[model samples]
Target: MWWFLICLAALIGGYFIYGSFIERIFGINEKRATPAYTQQDGVDYVPLPTSKVYLVQLLNIAGVGPIFGPIMGALYGPAALLWIVIGSIFAGAVHDYFSGMLSIRNNGASVPSITGKYLGNSPRHFMNVFAIILLVLVGVVFVSAPAGMLTNLINEQTSLHLGTGAMVVIIFAYYILATIVPVDKIIGRLYPVFGALLIFMSVGLMTAISFSGEHTIMPGFQFGDMFSNLNPHDMPLWPALFITIACGAISGFHATQSPLMARCMENEKNGRFVFYGAMIGEGIIALIWCTISLSFFDSVDGLADAVSHGGPGNVVYTSSFGLLGVFGGILAFLGVVILPITSGDTAFRSSRLILAEYFNLEQKTLKSRLMMAMPLFVIGGILTQVDFGIIWRYFGFANQSTAVIMLWTASAYLIRHQKLHWITSIPALFMTTVCISFILSSQTLGFGLPMQISTILGFIGSVAVLAYVIKVAGKHKNLSHSDKATDNLTRIT
Candidate 1:
């Protein structure tokens, strides 16, 4: 009951406090100027209402990462939830909000572009390459786990043997609709219904689980026991926790999603609401998943077996909805279907943006869009054969590494703009320090001295990149001053 109340408080606080920030930061109000380059159309570039934008951001950001991050965090005990909540608001939400705002200010340019503006060309390119590699790793590992869970849910409910084939069909259908149908027509109208259904089903499942009187799964380790679980073979708690939180803290995908959302913002002020607000909602979703995992499963082995065998062979969802019996099963199935669609759509849109930016493809054509998405579809299909659990850990690490780069960029932006609020920089700095420390620790303790040496080299490389960013910032400031002086002289003449 306390947990429920906590969650409700987080949601209400997020909507009101963070929602107001959105209006202040990105709203269409007169305080912030809209980018002149934003080409507003009734379709792709159309400005959405704040509520609609919030829903899209929520759906786009609420992927498997949130679900799995909390589950991993729960390994450290319920105390981890405290970090998840605080970090979501401070570190995660701030990073996401700024990334979107930067993209919008630069005409929907990607993080790589923003990095180049503040950092040098070489560092920008390096970060972009790193981000793509991380994203691909993420796609390979993280994309299929939810699909597996969804398949299991369908199979258990209908006694139908849904497999990767079913997953493929569903993903393909979403892509087709996203590509063929107009964004304005489909997103505001149909997508909200899907979003509402997902929320309803998730809530219903939680309620059913609570009332069913099933054995509640608790964290295996106490707070003190977390470090003791560190083993040479099994990934240690510190590193694992670091990676998991890093994904939540900062992600390259946030960069992609921000720009996509920026295209739909009615004004710059909406950034706070859409970008930060959505992140808070995503954090809440992660919290719920973690809570469910902790409350439902008895042991680590049981949870592993469930993940390995397609999410407890769907019995978990079915049993979760036990309150409504058959009706609950139906709701569970609908939720299962909706989860993948939300993620798949976001992936499709993001991949399109990346391709359009990198290859300079014409986004208006059907062939161009299909070509952009083909690689992801092909790779996703192949990855279905591999073990996702092990891969997911690596993805978490790589995703965090990407986030580190974004934090670097965002922190630089904050400094350059002289908006160096401690609320923003402190969280960014803390997450950056955590990520770098974990990488160093992973190399030293986990991978030995030689790996540690490589990690040090990576750290050096990051420092060099930071130096380059500082140099560019200095140059940009000088240029701004020079331009202002020239304008004054012209006025005097």
Candidate 2:
């Protein structure tokens, strides 16, 4: 519990200290008009209040991620604590800040466009396709999980005629309507309500933890304990820990969501609060969930047994029900049902924006918006029929893979402008290692190589990629012949 409080404080303090420092590095200029104000498209580039944008962004990046991921991540014991704090401060917040600011600087362009601008055409094209696919996977996963939960919840209550398939169709209909409409219509208004419920649920659980008198549940952290896997499967601590806990720490998908808020931000200064602050807020939520999950079950082994018997959803349900009784059940429903539904809506919306930006299609018109979104939703609907585990597996790897690309792109943008590129470059290289190592070592995919071999190959691959990026950035600088163009890009946008 003391460890949990310390981590929570560290995340808050990191926001004021490290978060502000990153903002300074990015050079937020207040005088310049943001895309929301400058472009002012009624459909897409509408300016929103800072508070609303923050809530929308929070709900966008969060969904069920911070809840489910951290619960599963706690399988590794105290090591999850270290990653949530350090990764959120240095890696996750920074990744989100730069991605959002970069989008704002590029007229609210999608990640592919921004990446293309810095990393050149090939990577941009790749990011365009890759980001869309990732978003689609996210959309499908969120859709299926929540829709199924709702179906069960309803079926259990009364003999509802609705099946999971019918629920999917109903939810996807809402998703389509939300995706094609203006930002402020459905998402902007409803997000603050959803965000409030999420915060309420988190606070309730945290309060329950404080008064539970469950001292025997949460174990003290020790140096030796940090290195050992507490998970039943003995999952390796390096890449598995990092991958299992991507959202609370850092995730590539945040880059995709950043532009959504970027388009709605009324001022460049708001990016810090909306983007970086939201990620920090998510870290706090993840931290709370981690502690609750570890302590609520009486022991890590007990928690692992429950997880094995049910799933992460079981962890959430049993923990919440155990701690808060009827209220906890309500919170459980929100965590399992409402959270994922909200995330699914934004996932599809972000997908629409990605494709629209890729094709330079205007989203103000109904026809254009539908043209960009119809096929994407169709594909997502088709995928909802496939196995959720397969889609989730691919999404986990792909999520970090996209993060590697965004980080390197931000690093290149800094390099071309003669700024401190290592801020992003270092994390980029680190995540590169994580992604590569996870692929090589994961049983679900890649060669089931030993951890030692995977670690070595991951290190080599990451450094090589970093070197290649540096070369490309250097060549781009030489060809462009001036930092003036980079400066102009920001100024004009």
lDDT by residue for model 2 (1-493), tens: 6777788999999999988888888888876788887778888788888988988888888866787788889888978978999999989999999999998887788899899988889999899889988999999989988876777566645777677898899989999998988999988898888888788888788887788775443655566665567776777778888887888899998999999889889888888898999999999999998888878776678778888875777787677767787656666566657777887888888888888777777788899989988998889989988997798788888888999999999998887766788889989989999999889988878888888999999999999988888887876654364445434534434
- Off-target runs (Cα >4 Å) in candidate 2 are 155-162, 214-217, 220-223, 476-493
TM-scores, all candidates, are: 0.80, 0.95
Best model number under lDDT: 2
Error of 1 at 78 (Å): 1.2
Position 218, candidate 2: lDDT:
69
Q: Tell me the TM-score of model 1.
A: 0.80
How many collisions between residues are there in candidate 2?
A: 0
- Evaluated at residue 492, the lDDT of candidate 2 is 30
Candidate 1: RMSD to truth = 5.3
Model 1's alpha-carbon lDDT is 0.60
